[model samples]
Target: MKSKHLILIFLLIVSAKSRAQTNHQTIEVAQVDSKKNNCVEIPSTFSHEILSESKSLNALKSKKIRRVELIYTRYKENADFDQNQLNEDRMSRLNQLLPKLQIDKPEIVWIEQIGATTSTDAKNYFHGFRIYTDVAPVARTYQRTHLNDLANPAVDFLIDNTIGGTFSHPSGTQIHIPANAVIYDNGKPVFGKYTISYSEYRNAAEILFSGLPMEFKDKTGSYLFNSAGMYEIRGTKDGQTLALQKDLSIDFNCTKNEAGVNFYEMNDQTGEWNLLKSDLFSANNPNETPSAKPEIMSANSEQRIKRGVAPDNYETEGSSKVYQQLNLVYGLISSKFGVYNCDQIFRIANKTIISPKYLDVSSKKPIKNQNMICLIDKDVNASFSFGVKQITCNSQGENIFLLFTEDGEIYALKSEKDKRVNLNQKEPEFLMENITNKVKTSDDLKSYLNI
Candidate 1:
């Protein structure tokens, strides 16, 4: 009887310990904060860290995240049908770069042949692919690891840069990679070549983009603690301006109350780092097709469309006139009106890429008012709005425009430099544009404007 009692007591103790440990590990489960749709939102800190980190960027944890999207673009094919060969080389190089990452072979996603007309430059067949990975965040893992809690001083320093309470906004950063420009790791406001085209990498090693220089070290793009409490690399390519970045390759894990923070060793001593267990998933603008709308753009501003130019480098006279024109429109909205409230875009789509990105503007806000917009860079990448300001990103950019009226109507057309001049430019008109009209509401906003 005594022996039996001792065995039972021991089993109970072991069971309780096992349960405690399980609870201690971090897991991301999706819980609908609002019922409009199902999405996995990163904690505010996570989004800020991820954006700031994406700036330093570029890769993630393996076990915690089981997938990633590999994206690339080519301007011209080499002489000997080498376009395919080159793509293969790049894909192989990526796999080799992330030996630990579980990614499959690359498959062609888009093949474009352009001529010198409205679109500049001609090219042979272009090939690219979206490689799925279960092991990757080459550097971003560090931030995700400490999401629930701050671990190291370096991370702590970075976390401060990420969004915080009192003030929270997306990282509207656009880093452009001009032709042959010296890729600086950390000379300007943000560190990155921003120049991530095939013309930029030039080598297999560059595919990894992790150890370029300490300047481009993204704290959030490091390592994270997986469900098993094991450390691994993982980070999603938040957005890219590849030729025309169609949309973001979204990597997400649903949550009950919305949390995807994977913990790590240097985690808080005692905090709610691992309270939930959920499955993480990945998404992207798989087959993004640019909008083919023929609309008149009264874009006459120069400051708005500058890519690769940081907030500090705004006055480059040689920047794109077209880019500046659009920027002028955006500038008008910002200066006159309030910061876009995530559901407002003052101007219509000037240019749309082939890649598709389902603009996610806080599905949780019941009465939220923010509009998002996207554009492509150099015909290879796209930029999504981080907030109101449109910054170039990984092949995709999203900006939220604010509306000053109820029923989500009335967008302000303010001008940059507080000048109330309207450049006499007509808002971008999309005609025959292959734009995707999402039927989110019973009545379409376009219908109200008779678009």
Candidate 2:
């Protein structure tokens, strides 16, 4: 009886061990399947609409995330097409269309766009793009490594037959192939560029606009962080002054409150970056149909200006805060007025600098009644009762004021002291008053500042 009992105990122990191992294996298999289904597979030959929908829908189906970041690497096409034919096509369009409707060859070519979206509750999504050359080999490696994070482009390119390799050389040939790129949101092109490198490896690059040597680098992949600003490119092409104007903002991530680059351009001479009338989705104006003579702009002029001009630093007591506030207000006003046709705010600020009404604090004193103006006063309480008051003076004695009105509107005012503003001043009058707008609540004030 003792022998039989020992045998039964041993068998029961063996059975328990077997059951434990089986459960462990089942868990391991389940984990692998979970990882596999973590990503949403994109279909080939999808339109921009379908691609966007896939991102949003796939994002929703994932685990509950507070934020989803979608990063897109712009499309990169091969240079197989005849350069001569492409140039001829541009010329053909230029010749057929009137000068006003003329377009130019997009210096930037974007393709193989890959991005990822992370979402919270699948309803709010944040998208970001990796600004890299999506060459096939690099993309393939990225795909295997970043399956759950990186987006897959609908189409991709294969490496040329010119280079073959089991491994790349330590010091390979330094080839500089022109590349084009742009940032987009919801199928709309926001920022266009000619800043990409097409080679075996991806180049982390920055953008150099036509008239600016300032290299704006992309942060957190190829997307510029806090990039909502205005950029201008103006030059004389064929003696008919040409200008490229860009108004850029970020597509705010709903969960994180972070923004990525969203760029747009205006029709030449429209003086407004109107999304409805302008091309919003194309980095190279893909939607712009009419072709114009190839625009030839040299970077030399921009370089010269950047080197020659040094910005004046206004050192004044408590004026720094005033300047900061003024900048915030300017941005807000510009955005609110973005709908209406207007000149660049900097130009307006420059014009305001020469206004005679602006106090030259270098030689003047902050007076309550001297700089104030009243457009209307119901009680005939004019003078300083409903206008600007100089609250502080900079080291150069520039007046910084707190502007207020009877209708509960208030603004911060600063005297423009840039050399360019002074040189361009034909007359000194009170144009700086444009900075003063009556707004209610600090939130309204902050909104104007775009904070």
Candidate 3:
């Protein structure tokens, strides 16, 4: 009887250890109401180990989730690790996985907490994720119409997926896809006809209007992108998105032939740009034989012309040609379907962070949340979007500041040539001239700023 009792105790201990190892971390999904105290927690057996097949996710799929707040807990045992980087990695993994489980992209808010470290057990120290779903959606703060108008339209092309081919943009940018290179998200092969949508942001107007983020953040600090050219390409079939099983080639034409330009791709979920590869520019040949390639060139020249840094017809003599032979091309190879940019980092020296108050010219009243502020450094092909926040700018660089109102109004702060603003002062009020009637389009805005 004693031996049988000992065996029973041993079995119970083993079973408890097995359960602890299997369920190392818990993931809870809670529904949040308007009142902070009214959070109703749903019973969740969802653990990190079974995230892919969680019944908690199924419960969320039926409801309309406006925002998702991810509350993550880290134990003191991992205090040495970089919390910000770990947060980003976990958030990125969740963002990628949640969408696959039929959860649409919602506004994701991350909250970090430190867990108690009284127990030295590894399972106790394991990080956990608690998700709070907000059903009530908030109204958009900015004017989407103005942003949409400024954005460049995608150039679509239908391609045969079975036998891949090269497609050229009117700007002379060529996308070369290999045969049988397309696949669905689940690694399933895709066949038949697929549509490829491509968009390019070559110049200041294109970059500014596209509303695509050019800021790259690293461990050191945030840096702006001095782009040679930026392009977004995506593949889809019938309404489903497609991915590249292999790398596709891009013969990117650009006006600038600068060396040391690296390729970067933006994260669809986080809006973060990750550096992929670097390429050198080949020597320019005006009479060189053109491949069925596309052009990313002329933007550098066009920008220079617009900024009065270069003479008119620097690369052309009033030619109606899209692909100018005089421009340089950077051969880029990408394995993903998303936004790609060939750019160099523009480090802002002596940076100043200022929360300037915006005032209307006509009424002389302070404007808040009703306008979007943009600071453009045309020399470096860098633009910063300051939407009711502390604006950071290079104290030495000649930056152009423009305010875009909600009601389609435009205003500009007069920047004198080589006159630098005193970075020491805080809360400087900028009186801007309302140039709404003069600027009809992005081109007009660019011209007006140049003048």
TM-score of each predicted structure versus truth: 0.20, 0.16, 0.59
Candidate 2 colliding pairs, count = 38
**What lDDT score is found at residue 250 in candidate 2?**
16
Name the best candidate (by lDDT). 3
State the lDDT of candidate 3 residue by residue for 283-402, as single tens digits.
432324355433322323232221112233343223233544323353577788988888888677878767666787677887644456777875777556764435777766677788
Q: What is the lDDT of candidate 3?
A: 0.59
The superposed Cα distance between candidate 3 and the true structure at residue 445, in angstroms, equals: 3.0
Writing each residue's lDDT as its tens digit, candidate 1 over 1-451 gives 9999999999997676444311011111111111111111111111011111121113433322233222222333333444434434443444444455443322223222222222122211112222332222312232233211211111000111122111100111122112222212222232332322111111111111111111111224322121211111111112422121111111111111112322111111111122121221112212122243222111112234222222433332322211111111010011110001111111223432221122223332222243322221222111122222122222122221212111222232212234322222223211111112322221222222221
Q: Which candidate is the best by TM-score?
A: 3
lDDT of 2 at 290: 22
lDDT of 2: 0.23
Residues 43-144, candidate 2: write the lDDT tens digits: 222111122223433333322221111222222233363423332333233223212212321112212222212222111211111111111121123223
RMSD of 3: 11.5
Alpha-carbon lDDT, every model = 0.22, 0.23, 0.59
